[model samples]
Target chain A: MLSEFDLIAQYFTRPPRANGQVALGVGDDCALLTPTAGMQLAISSDMLVSGRHFFADVDPYTLGHKSLAVNLSDLAAMGARPLGFTLALALPEARAEWLAPFAKGLLALADLHHCELIGGDTTKGPLNICITIFGETAPGQALRRDAAKIGDDIWVSGTLGDARLALAGYRLNACKNDPDEPLGGQINLDASNHALAAARMHQPTPRVALGLALRGIAHAAIDISDGLIGDLGHILQRSGVGAKLSVDDLPLGAVLAQQPQTIQRHFALAGGDDYELCFTAAAAQREAVLTAAQNASTKVTRIGSIVADPGIAFVAADGTALDLQLSSFDHFRTT
Target chain B: MLSEFDLIAQYFTRPPRANGQVALGVGDDCALLTPTAGMQLAISSDMLVSGRHFFADVDPYTLGHKSLAVNLSDLAAMGARPLGFTLALALPEARAEWLAPFAKGLLALADLHHCELIGGDTTKGPLNICITIFGETAPGQALRRDAAKIGDDIWVSGTLGDARLALAGYRLNACKNDPDEPLGGQINLDASNHALAAARMHQPTPRVALGLALRGIAHAAIDISDGLIGDLGHILQRSGVGAKLSVDDLPLGAVLAQQPQTIQRHFALAGGDDYELCFTAAAAQREAVLTAAQNASTKVTRIGSIVADPGIAFVAADGTALDLQLSSFDHFRTT
Candidate 1:
């Protein structure tokens, strides 16, 4: 059995990066980070528990990727450049096979974004992964959720709901093997579509570049972690404004678009784990928004407009009001 | 049965302090913090598991206090002033009875230190608390473990072994109730002594002020979390220097002072959960060290001196060698 320090040294510790932001890294009582002059620090934390956030037998490699990816998504929402992150993990045991690939997947993403893993703690317990990530943004330049203007156009980056479709497929498969397992509805997908949805669910691409690109163009933003309707509701509630969302105009994931209209609408509107960016911008900046998306090489869709009213008014392509009851993912309220 | 958002709002969320360091607090995708000019941010993370770190039925208030206390102790070791923190908690269920006191204990300590709760994530799982604390210190001023030098006097703050004694008492009680329970040896403590030890174990006072005061005085410092022997080994390993420790000179907790010599030696040397600061400084700065301790209103005791060798040499009051086999706490190797 590996000691806690040995496990951390083998799987997590890395030499300090040349960036010099981290004055002292791992192996210290506390990691020291030199903040960029005149920049504000954007911080966010997310926790993932086995059997709640992810499957007990989910690939450890993907689990590692998703754990850090979800937190990076928050930094992306704030239009902040990645700085570093601290991971606090509770594992059942120190198995080399599980740790090697898990670290590989986690560091692969960290390396891609140049976000160094500065420090963390490891302990023996039920499986849990918590990451607190830091990023840097110019003061007052962060795209806040409460900054959405009344005349702003709502834009979503990439696609939504494929992760939810993947989850439904997993649940459906489990229900087939164990009849006692609750199946919300009869949901099925072909093998290829299942793979596509699963990939989105496991390996989310945080729109960091798009966020940086839209720093000046975007008025307000939030990463679509808890579906479009639910996440956008945060912006509306905080901004003290309402929105008119075109349900038919919602960008569907490639795999999600193949499903029936009812499934597409339900999953796209109410699905969790999308991890795409849902942001608002003035109508005049529509061209700027498109240019920013082009620069970031990410897709953008104008699916709605911020309104002066108090609650969201979902509408069809023909502008007919549609009533859709959707509640965001709540850890306690949900399974 | 509160929703996750409602639970956070009710117990965790607080209005931003007038200090104005937190540009944005809870209810956002990410919290924005404005760093002080020329100050480096000190970050540390700690995770406490239910069964391993604390008793399953322990008081929620103390658990809350200790959860943040342990993290703050890391900052204290780094000589960093409290700034802010992010909490990521996993609970088995959302029960108001548990959360109310837990948050109270946590916030009380946080308020004392002026560490604002900026942002966090809440989820449902086996109870766990992971707090990533932030503090600030001027560049190159942090008392790192690698800065210890030969001929430096090793000093420890407050008391040692009381927490360990308290733990032994609990384990002994458990062993009495269940004979199958492992008891290292027959041990007993009076009720009042147990309470003192228990307080030390549960609500440790992180020496933040002393750490700040010792900025240029202490050469290298580390908080004694994993017992003095294990924690001091880190300094020796990192600094490439050893020490001559006077085991008899270790300041014992008031309750621990009444224990037998063997028990005192064992717990004082290898007992974990002691949040006192163990630091090293040049012999010439003894008066300066005392002044710093006085300024912080914390007691300090010199019990050892750094040596040229690569490992610690335990000694008696008469300077005679004392051979004692002691191993530091390793999360995976211990219990």
Candidate 2:
């Protein structure tokens, strides 16, 4: 029976750790942060609801990590450095067990990026976690959605589809939708691969460094949260351009690569929640792009090229248009 | 059925109207804001959930206005001017009839404060609204809770207790807990008074102008979402000081004034959700405080003085200590 104030003081309240940026922190009417001179502040918010966004028994540690990670990804997409974040949490009850690990996981990531937990509100209700993150970028250096050129090359960081594959496998195995299938109707994945996929799904490493490096190197950037094709469509819509993506060049880890060709392509292109950086850069900046990737110690693969035509085309190895109609997961459509 | 994207685009999206400060607005991974040089960004978040914060059938319009108003009140307490905000919404379903009015109320308030709707995530779930608002104040100009000094005069803007009175009357009437009461076994209030109290509960005017004018004039400040004594306890705790409050001097509008003396004092002292600005200033600055209130066109009343003692004493008009155990609403305790 912890009061909301006690709950906040115990689990959420922390000393102001983001020095230089945070002027005032928690236990105030409003937290204050001073933006660096010549820098623009980038802000975004995301909410995760139980049952809809995560399972009731999902690991609180992973849940906490995912909550802030998604927000940091937004800053990453904008090529902004993480500054601080405020969390608004609603809980059915204040269980110390869940909160301890949850706070640990959340703060670990925050500490890693120097994104202090500045201020937040906690209330008793159905479980919901909303985080609003702030970041900063120099006046004109932010990677924007509308800045892509027609002839720019489209690139994706790290691998894609593993998280979605993990989700699909877990759903197939746990729900046993295909009752006639063998092995308890479960799509059994190798233990290591399953773990990797699950880790990707649960604990996405935001591409903060890669994004900072790509600030001037990339023109338009977006984080791959709604799968590659759909998120790329956002850039296309904003920049008023088209893209030609080669299925052959789509980045995939060994686990995802071992899947059936259709499954691999589907998951790689339309499976959401990868949380990787996708960007468009000038073809002439190929060397610079490589240098930036090397500087970040992250893998960057060119997967497509932007075109003047105003529609996306998925191409095969022979340059023929793929006839497959794969669409990303839309929350309303899925429901 | 509306997908999350469509819901956001139709109900939440708008052309970037917060021009000069916003570098990028909606339709991006993150909204970018350029704070004025030598200014500090003030940030605060608030969450309102159905059943917990409001009735399920509460007018979507008032809910929208309130959802943002409460957050704005936090900024107002800090003497911060509204800049922009990000909304994270969870809806049980996408009902246009409900959403239309909700968005209208929300955007109207945003327009009034020039608080741009910058970026947010919309999801399908239990109805909840969380808004994180951003504002700015110049260096050393923002009002703070810990800045109160012993001997500083305590002042409250506008009236108090109407919202709490409204809640109490509604609860008492609907529940009929006291069968001994008259008027169909329920306490009765006149129509006009009830309407005034209800409006106070529903749409609190955040004292933004008074707060802006209080910069350098007020030593410490807080907006009374919680009751006077409880919220003022925050300033006491932070400032390491206590107060001697004159219950007689507590400001009350006609509706609250008509209540029984005990009930009036209880609600005015410890009943929450008033949203009026309670500030502290040096006794010598009385004239300046009056000037600030005059400039903002808001009423201000001095009710107490901060003392070096570590506990509050509510005194009677005859200088006798009032031994009333009035505590503010603690959500967990209330539940």
Candidate 3:
């Protein structure tokens, strides 16, 4: 059996890439990093367990990508430029077949963003991956959740509900037509839609460039990890404000739109793991906000407006308030 | 049952202390840290799991101290000053009783070192704790394992083998002697020795001050986590040199000194979790090294010297080379 050190040396310890931020990478007690002058370091941590975060048989490569991607999303929400990350992994055993692809997926994204793997620990235990990411941002430039102000327009990047649809398809096995379910009214996804949703679920893009572009334009920001409404609620709570979200304007991918209207609304409002940035910007910056989205090569939809009230209100297309009981996934909450 | 968010807010979240290094701490998507200009960031991660790293019934307070202590030790080895840390904790349940003392112990040490708890994730899973620590060092001033030179004196900070002795005593139940094996001689620790060993095992100081002091005086340094000989071997291998260790000169605590000679040697050479700094310096710098240690208020013992040869030699008091099979703990080793 390969030892933890051997595994790390063989797979994780690559020659340091020419990232000036990383002064020292791996092979030492600690890695040394040099943040740019006048830049504040943005750091975040995320942990993923086998059963809780993903299926036991989930693709190792996708698991690797999602693990780092989730942590990167936190940085993205903060409008920070990725610098380096450390992975603390606990594995049941040292299996080369599983590790090779996992490293590939992890490093591919790291390379894409110019983020280096600085240092981490490997141990033998239940399969769990914890990543702590470091990034850099100019002082007072981060999109903070407590910075939202009255009359700011709430915006969301990309489309939501696709990942949730992908999950629902997997859970209900609805990718295939089931004649017996004609009366059961289960939603079925076509192969093309299925592929789109699955990709959205498995390999999320962290919208890093979009966040960087929104650094100065957005008043407050948060990533849509625990659905749009719940996450936006966090911003509102922190800012001591509220929001009025337009249900009809909520961005929905074509695949998610084909579902029942109620399902579409539910998934878009409450399903988690979208990994898209939700931010609020002053109405006067509308032109600049659109330019920022274009510069980052991402789409942004104006979904709501911040208000002085203390709770969220959902407005339907008919101008009637939509009352929906919704809650995000709480780890300790009993089903 | 407390939700993960509630648990974090109740137990882990605290007001940002007046550490100017932390720009933004807990309650954000990412913690913002400000590293000193012209200083490099030193980062390290360590994970501890129940049943594997500690006893199932280990005190949450000690476990908390140890979980963060081990990671800080890595920074200490690099001669970095503690800045802040992120704790990713996966707990089986959110029990207030267990969390209270755990947080108390963790924050007490953090306060001592001025290391703020920046940000991290709390999840429901098998009990595990992963801490990623951040520190700062002057550019190129880190004490590295690859910097040892030939003929440099090897020095170790503080005493060794006491933690291992405590472990053995606990494993062997030495406090309650068994009369059935009269011929089986096992060293018994008195109350004072037991207290010393237990304290060493439960709450290991990271030697951060000593490491910071050794930056210019020492050529190479490492924390003796996996015993002296094995960890020193890392320095030798990395520095392209060997060492000649005089076992008679090794600093032993009072408890370890009372053990049989063989047991004392074995514990000193192969035991793990000592968390003491082992460093090398030029022979001419011995007085400076002693002064550095004195400035840090830590004891330093010169035990060996770097040699031109490629293998370590252990010599007895009579100058005879000793042949003993010693190996450090390998997590994946089946035996």
Candidate 4:
């Protein structure tokens, strides 16, 4: 196995990291780049620490992919194009065999998105990975959640809650023999869409191109890493408006279609890690978006509509309404 | 405490990030910035975990400043202007008291350098901090270690070995009640120079201004974080050149000059955390650099010259060469 130095030279260091937008990269005391004309940089960051974000025994390759994926999802939500990213890695100890596949996964995503690895530092400690991703967009063209308003049609791409089901399955599988909530090795799915949702749960794809397409077309947008209802609340709150979502209108996949009603409705509204775009558009722009979705072969279901009221409300199948009191995962939460 | 949503709004969501270079910034799903015209972006990153880079009991304010200072030093070494930075902070638990002060120190340094806080993420874990700093310079203008040429004069800013001295005192301070090594709480300095050295150790300043001044003048540059001998070795290895140093020319601060010859030489030649600029310039620029140094009110001492032999040689007071085999601290070294 190569030492950390050899591993860095072989995999991490590239010949003067070249992305089309950079002035200088990789082989310098610092990489340098000039901003392109008529563009703004979009940025976001995420830190994934051992045990907090992933299991210690999880595949390093998967961890690498997921780490970048979550950050890319942020860029997609902002309607920006990936430029490049810097990774800061902390390891308890250097493990050459583990690093190779991990680097492969990280670079693979970088290649797919055309995001070059400009710079990074490696040190020691409990494994921690923090990645800061940069993206570009035309000035004032990036989508934000603050513009959703009354009379706007609310929409979401892909399905919601598949990721949650998959997560449950993963946890259940790990503790199959445990006395508590004893579901065996098989992932316990509530029949809404076991197969598809599980896959969605594990490797949620960021709707990058869709976000770009909706930059001007959509009134406002957010990436649903959190559940749809909660993520949409951001738009409503920022826009000083309200929303009414119908559980019946959701695009629950095959599993939910086959599930019991209670489970299907709950998962459809409250499940997280969709990594899909939840957006709004003026009633007038609806046709254009629908047409665009047809051409792009992606779904943009009008799950609800904006309201003059200033909060979120879920409409039942029979027209009953309930205010959700749940919150998504809070890593830094004190309670 | 407020939910994760409020925490982001209150602390994480910074000023509508208007990096003129970035097309977009925080609060959006992603961040965007255009590289400056004809310039490439220089990038670097580092992470400091609790119990790794510092003691847990150290002041958060100091920790924050040091966290940023270390990353900024990377940019300073490249002679790149400070642009912006992102911080990913992982905590075992949220403490408002800890966070507010930490942000204060981090923000103070960022403002001092005109570097904006572009983006970052937060999570719960064993306190870890990953900082990525982005800066830029015109294409081909960044200083690099590999460009040193034979006959180039080697220069370093400030003095060295003070940080180690400070560390020594800090350790002894922890063991005041013990008589181990026949030492106590009070330092056995030649005078109070050790106190000055200790401060230099604790808060070594990065030489950004001096470095920017040397742009287009210095042939190669690197920041002196590691000891001179070891760090200079990096320049030599990358440039495939050698260096001959006059030990008498080593910049021993007044604090160490009155000490025993061994301690003085060791501290002067082998001290780390100096955060000074160690650069090589063509002989023709010597006068210009000295002039610039005078204007900046900072010292620029030329200790050696790059040679064709491709290794480092130290000429002692007796005119005999000594090979210093000590390597400075490696963050990843296990032993």
Question: CAPRI verdict on model 2?
Answer: medium
TM-score of the first chain of model 2: 0.94
DockQ of 4: 0.58
Best-to-worst ranking by TM-score = 1, 2, 3, 4
Residue-wise C-alpha lDDT for candidate 2, range B1-335, written one tens digit per residue = 23554555568886778448998888888998999898999999988878877778988898888889999999999999999999999888888889989999998998988889888888878888899999999989999999999999999999998887777666666676733222223334777788889898888888999999999899999999878888898899899999999999999866889877877787788777788999999999999999999999999999999999987888988899899876676311132
What local distance difference test score does each model get? 0.88, 0.85, 0.85, 0.72
Candidate 4 lDDT score relative to the true structure: 0.72
**Model 3 lDDT per residue over A178-294, tens place:** 442221255767778888888988899999999999988999999988788878988999999999999999999768998888778888887778899999999999999999999
Query: Which regions in candidate 1 have their CA more than 4 angstroms from the true location?
Result: A1-5, A176-188, A330-335, B1-6, B177-186, B330-335
Query: Which CAPRI tier for candidate 3?
Result: medium
Model 4 residue runs over 4 Å out of place are A1-9, A14-19, A173-187, A190-198, A253-258, A294-297, A322-325, A330-335, B4-25, B32-36, B172-195, B317-319, B330-335
- Name the best candidate (by TM-score): 1
Report the C-alpha displacement of residue A264, candidate 3, in angstroms. 0.4
State every prediction's TM-score relative to the real structure.
Answer: 0.96, 0.95, 0.94, 0.89
What candidate 2 gets wrong by more than 4 Å, as runs, is A1-5, A178-192, A330-335, B1-5, B178-187, B190-192, B330-335
Stretches off by above 4 angstroms in model 3 are A1-5, A174-185, A190-192, A330-335, B1-5, B174-195, B330-335
Top candidate when judged by DockQ against the true structure: 1
Report the Cα lDDT for candidate 1.
0.88
DockQ of each: 0.72, 0.66, 0.58, 0.58
Docking band of candidate 4? medium
Which scores greater on DockQ, model 1 or model 3? 1
Scored against the true structure, residue B150 in model 4 reaches a CA lDDT of 88
